[model samples]
Target: MTTVEPPSWQSLRAAEARLINTGVPGVSVGNAVFESIVTGLRESLLRLAAPQQAQALGVPPVVSRGLLERVGYIDGFPNLVGTVYSFTGSGADWNRLQEARAATDAAWYQEQQISEVALLPATCHHIYPLFEGVDLPGPAVLTAEAHCYRHEGTHELGRLRSFRMREFVRIAAPDDCIRWRDDWMEQQRAWLTSLGLETSVEPASDPFFGSAARLMKATQREQELKFELRVPVGDGLVQAVASCNYHKEHFGEPFGIRVAGEPAHSACAAFGLERIVLALIAAHGDIPADWPQHVRSVLSLDDAGVA
Candidate 1:
């Protein structure tokens, strides 16, 4: 049997650079066609969620540092966190900063104070806190898209330092939350197949930092709390384009979100917007004009209506 190997990161990166401008190492400015695919995928997700009366929210790209700490983000993935810092210096400090800048003293920027908010690591992170101290009469569903950041050093085609995530979060009883996630897993697979991408849903775990995180990862997988929808990105690697996570009272207890006087169970379906676009490009090639009719039609590329 002949096996088709995945493309390498170098090849994908080159293709992306040709198709979209990548002035920043881990960030890129997508062309019109690129944006169209992203928008179409995002819209498709929204359409899939139409049955549920999900309250749509537009969360800020940055969230308060205090909130992040409360959610244990600092304890778990501190390495990936990005803090916003600004120049809060007086006149003398400003003068010193300018002088240091002229001399190319990188350390001079450290004089600035850290801002109250930090770049959001995920779209769902900010949603859970909003329900704090509220007793959910029933299941609450929230849909949001936000720019997220991670400080992972390596930047490849599918992996980015900063990216966009479209998330659907459900806060409800344990059974309801699990069912919602499983249903969406199947639904998401069907949608991805419609877009002509081969996908698989498998048990997964987060990249928890530090030596102790090994136990956390094993526990997560053992409990089957996380699952990912993976698509071939390149170099024999399948990247996670979306994930279904079951946080069993992890966020609820910390945030005081209760349902029926008990701590609510929360789950989220998160889609990596840029990775989906990259997968589409990898599967169909970068040229929109040469893509399959179905692909173009699904993405609404012919009419430029995706935006």
Candidate 2:
């Protein structure tokens, strides 16, 4: 992986003209320039996943609460998971809700009840439940993109609460799974370099909450189960624009996903599209004409009349 000091690390609103911030905090909608870059990135990722014989798939944004519980996500990311709630009450309760709507939020929120489903924090979580109890002799390679929600409690650049995540997941034996992640780490370095983005692959871990979870976080880094492609996105701020993770029998044991009569291991390469665009804007200028020729060509910004 190539590492260099980025010339500039502008803040979130630095490229305000290129990205339209929706009134909702931590949410922004992309304009043409943003869309063009995202499209190019997605296509490039697909090309990289092609040789792995990855099957293209689509999954819903919301995952079942039971599924998350079974997967232990509710334990690890309880603070970040956005639980879905709805008004499942009687006519008297509805009347109370209408009355409380004009009052405080605490009163209205009491009218809502948690549902069986919650917004997904990652795409791969939804994939495993599908292959439950299935024996995969072939060791599946699947690719998909989904809108994920994580209540990170910040509207910081490249750290949106709600974001789109694209993933290439492989379920196989332990060694095979780890090798796939290692290979993709190198592949992503070269691919991001093609877009004129300087990135570093550094050992990283999830934002596991609570005092006890610190040990989990530390162990993850110590074992190098997760590695992030860090990109300079803000002043003194580096964000993970992509990540490769090795989940050793974590999903297989719960889902009963077997490979050659044993619980399969899993690994995935995940790309954060919006964050990558932010990195590009900070590296070059938000304007297409100001970007490097190779970067512009790779993103096909001019083909879409971005200039």
Candidate 3:
């Protein structure tokens, strides 16, 4: 395994701003410079999506716990899954929490109970359930934005516990699904390359949990069901900034969604928005003005309305 190094988060903020090392280890707080660059990134993606006629959609941050199970998230990635908890009790119970906090600051969380919902792990997970029990005579494409969370065993610069995600989903015939994923993967690689970042597309698999995970990962890689666009940050370490996944009846079978009288095949391309922004900063610099002219032009960073 390659050693993961701590990221230079200080570069995420302006000169006068506080360092990016906020209280939370894997949480991010960006400065104006960072936000502007992020906007450009989002806009660039939207423009590319415009040609596909992908409908724009949005998903809530918290997802139904039962829904998470339906999506097989808990079974496949129980280690990375995060569940929400809340205090649900009368005034007397609140008093007990307060008393516990008074005794020890960390003990207060013990009073909270797990809620019905879990934090959204991936933006595309929500898309499947929306079409449950429905039939699609033709292919459908959707684009959505979500704030996702994962429980990371290790925290580093590019690996985050909470982050922004943008996903493009497709549900159709198996061949159509595969073609869509492949086409988008190529477009995404080109887009990132145009921004002056060196990128590599490689076969990949999810970090599956449990003893069977090893065999499952091997099967996934052998079948070429997933591909990732990996890039290097400031450090020597490399990470996947985007992924294209083809799920043949994975969600369709569970959700009873069909296309053309058959269980639909699905695919999605997900972008880790913050990770790409960080890669840009590492390749160029925090200052957008100092970036290569072509990179800036591709991102529209200098457009009068970009800010």
Candidate 4:
């Protein structure tokens, strides 16, 4: 076996703690550490996602409600939360506008006005619509770095209302979609193994809405819908660092994404950049320099060489 420099588990944890939020639901330093981990993971995953000369693109932070509606987000998640903003009732009266705005500055607003486009609730929603009218001879692999927001009622320390998601999407035939997900699982397993961390890859149920949705998840063994690569975050906290989803024919029909002449099958593996970092910290204590040499080698951050 090749020698690898271990990451500094302690320093990494300290860096992670700095990013974590001690206040209400918002952004924080902990999130920053999470992003770092995500970036590292992405660099590794991209090698597998688009081995050839493939390009990566980014989409807008704000998305149209019409687009979200097309994806069944409204129907499925009636209570689905997201950020929506409407204009103030200033109505050319600068005085009133300032006074009203300063009074509370809450979500209270006037009616009969246009609401700015809703912030993206999920990162992948925007990717499918980008190629709504395109035709591809083979699969199109795209990676997106998107900031997502939701009108959350409660917020936890690590889980924020607004977060960043890095998604690796594959638009291809059914077989190709399945193959990509399978191959990715193997790749992720190796990566985590090299890190010297214990992990589990299990078939996961969908985030189906309502009570019946849970039943469906149970009945179908909904593994393809999502498979989670989870690592214990200590103290009974197991974090899902990566998710592999096989959309089957769900998205193709809605978005008109086709492979050849048939409706295409779509699959994607999403890495919650922040969550993965947290998991690493929880697993190995922080400090990239202290990480096992073998793990560090996989990340290409050997102390003797540049990361």
| C-alpha local distance difference test of each model | 0.81, 0.82, 0.83, 0.67
Compare candidates 2 and 3 on lDDT and give the better one.
Answer: 3
Please write out the lDDT profile of model 2 over residues 1-307, one tens digit for every residue.
0111233133222323255556666566666556777887888788767788898888889989888888888888899988999989889978877777777565666767799999999989888887999998768999889989888877666768777899999999999999999999999888888887888989999988887698999999998999999889765578999999999988989988999888889999999988888888788867657888898777666776665
- For model 3, how does the per-residue alpha-carbon lDDT over 141-162 read when each residue is reduced to its tens digit? 9999898999898877778888
Candidate 1 residues lying further than 4 Å off, grouped into runs, are 1-22, 96-107, 305-307
| True-vs-predicted CA distance for residue 216, candidate 2, Å | 0.4
Q: How does candidate 4 score on lDDT?
A: 0.67
Query: Which candidate leads in TM-score?
Result: 3
Give the TM-score comparing model 3 with the true structure, all chains together. 0.91
What is the Cα-based lDDT of residue 176 in candidate 2? 93
Candidate 1 lDDT over residue span 220-259, tens digit each: 9999999999997654557999899999999898888989
List model 4 lDDT by residue over 1-307, tens digit each. Answer: 0001233344343433234443445554443344455556667666656564445877777899887777777656555456466665556655565567788663335443656477887778888887786777888887887877765555543455566777878889989999988887887777776667688998887555676676767753644567888886544577677778888877787878788977888988777666666666666666656666765665555533322
What are the models' TM-scores?
A: 0.89, 0.89, 0.91, 0.80
Descending-lDDT candidate ranking? 3, 2, 1, 4
